[model samples]
Target: MYEIVAGIDKSEDRGRAIAESITEMPLDHGEVRVTLLHDFQDNPEGASVDQVASVRHARKILEEVGIEVVLEESSGEPADAILRLADEQDAEMIVVAGRKRTPTGKVLFGSVTQSVILGTDRPVLVCSGDEN
Candidate 1:
């Protein structure tokens, strides 16, 4: 029953899987609040309506499993948004999706997963496509 916050994004499958996996974990006490945060870049056209709707729908599914969800939409960098939300929530654990990259690619692009791990004080759980 630990207070866990999950950072979700455009990847629906991976996000849902991460939420589901967190739900399955054994916690001792507090309730788990799964937050789905999407950072929309500032643009003339504004954010995609369909993307917002999709995240809302995903929140509904997670809510069904007894996970209290807070859906957030903001304009900023992904890593910054995630870290800010995690701090605001006082999350015991921060869960996010891990990107698969070759050694060269990881070195060049710099990994978001790595960034989160280094930037946050909370334990970061990365759910990848191949993770069991």
Candidate 2:
């Protein structure tokens, strides 16, 4: 089975994009497995990955099509957590969503998506979060 680690954030649109991309891929129902990951930098409320709304959204879409999905949670740096988890899981691919950002904005904010893409040797699937 092909294993994929999808690092989903709080954005509903981005989460949907990731799920849609996976659905559109030409894979058999049971041939692939997706692990939905949510890296929480700060969770005072103490939430699980399955409690995340975006994760729940993605899970629904993937499960509807008979794709095996696992929910995971981690703390600390998002990119680091995602990559480390992917390595531990021996995932075949990593999936992440990126928003359209101005060059200046990106430089100032620093992108977790960019970090994940560059940090991994495994294939990365980037889904556009921009609706337009």
Candidate 3:
């Protein structure tokens, strides 16, 4: 079975974008499995991965298309958690949502998406968070 680990943040738009991109793939219903991963750097409320809004949105979309979905939570740096989880899951690919940032902005604020792409040897799929 083909395996994919998707790292998603709290943005609903990013989740939707990721889901839509996955749905566009021409895989059979049961041929692939997707793991939705959320890294909680700080969670005072003690929320689970499934409780994340973006994760939930992505889960619904993926489930509707008959794809197997797993929700996993990690607590630490997002890129590190994502890479660790992807390795643990032995995923064939990694998926992440990208934010629109200027070069200066990226320089000021390091991007999790950028980190994931640079840190992984496996294939990485990046989906845009913007609607348009």
Candidate 4:
């Protein structure tokens, strides 16, 4: 089976697309299992809400294609939490959905996607978010 860890932020559209693309990938002779991860920094109340929404979105999309799905919510820096979980789970691939940002912007704002890409040796699939 394919073990995928998808780190979702505020981009629901791009996140869903990433999940769909992964689930659709031809698996030769195995099934796909996805762990939808949403890292919530302090604020438990708001974090719970966001986590629920993210899990719901991932479940709705992944389940429709008959892919097994689960939710993982953690506290800490988003990128760090995702990387830690991926390592712990030995995920085959890491997924993220975020907007494109220039190097200067990324440096200034500190991008979670970029951090994940640079931090992990695992293959990272980044889906561009929809323009809003």
Candidate 5:
């Protein structure tokens, strides 16, 4: 039962690339239980239209590789929400994507990806958003 937790932003611009990078990672022939999680709720009662679109896009990518997935949405701190889900699922890996930020900017306003990496002992696979 190999499980993975992936955190993503459902932005119109770069969400597809992030999802593609995660599913296209080199695999050693094991089926994955992928949880495609998006924490894009200010009031997390149900899936927003954009969140639904993000999940739909992500599912197609993972399914192409024969990996089954479930979509989940959460409200609250994005980084904390991701960690909680990973811990609950006992995930083997955590995948997150982010753009390159300046040191000053990072220090002033810490990033969700950075926070997740530092907060957990699990292996974090960071997919940079600058990829073409």
Candidate 6:
């Protein structure tokens, strides 16, 4: 069975959609392990804690599909956290939602998707938020 680790942000819809897509893929008699990861950005004003709701919702969805989930919280860069978790889990594939950014934003902050792709030897599946 191949372990599938999904990197989730605060977007509940995107997280659920990615989980569903992974569930639908043909496993060829293998099992799937779903992991929900969140990198909580530090907010001195306590605004970032609101991501708890999204993480909880994601856990519920995966559980409904009979997929065991490993939920973790990290205080670091999102890309770094995801890569570290994938490695720790010995995940064969890493899935994350693809988000579009303005050219200026892309230039200032390089794409996490690109970074993950370049950094890891394992296959990276990027699900476009617009895709079904």
Candidate 1 overall lDDT versus native: 0.72
* Cα TM-score per model: 0.80, 0.95, 0.95, 0.86, 0.82, 0.81
Writing each residue's lDDT as its tens digit, candidate 5 over 30-122 gives 477878788865654665634466567767777777887778778778899889999999999988887788999999988998999999999
- The C-alpha stretches of model 5 lying farther than 4 A from their native spots are 12-14, 28-30, 41-46, 49-51
Candidate order (TM-score): 2, 3, 4, 5, 6, 1
Give the clashing residue pairs of candidate 2, or none.
none
Ranking by lDDT: 2, 3, 4, 5, 6, 1
Q: Summarize candidate 3's per-residue lDDT along 4-112 as a digit string, tens digits.
A: 9999899999999998899888878588899999889889999898889999999999999999999999888999988998899899999999999899999999899
| Candidate 3 deviant stretches above 4 angstroms | none
Q: Give all candidates' CA lDDT scores.
A: 0.72, 0.92, 0.91, 0.79, 0.77, 0.75
The true-versus-predicted C-alpha distance at residue 6 of model 1, in Å, is 1.8
Residue 35 alpha-carbon offset, candidate 4, angstroms = 0.4
Top lDDT model:
2
The digit string of per-residue lDDT tens for model 2 on 28-51 reads: 968999999998989999989888
TM-score of 6: 0.81
lDDT preference between candidates 2 and 6, better one = 2
lDDT per residue for candidate 1 within 40-98, as digits (tens), equals 76546776523565466567676777777777766767788888888987878888888
* Candidate 2 all-Cα RMSD: 1.1
Give the per-residue lDDT digits (tens) of candidate 4, residues 12-111.
6777777777766776313878888877666645656335665677678787878888788877799999899999999999988877788899888999
- lDDT, model 1, position 53: 51
At residue 73, give the lDDT of candidate 3: 90
Let me know the TM-score candidate 1 reaches against the reference structure.
Answer: 0.80
- What's model 5's lDDT at 131? 45
- Badly placed stretches (over 4 Å) of model 2 are none
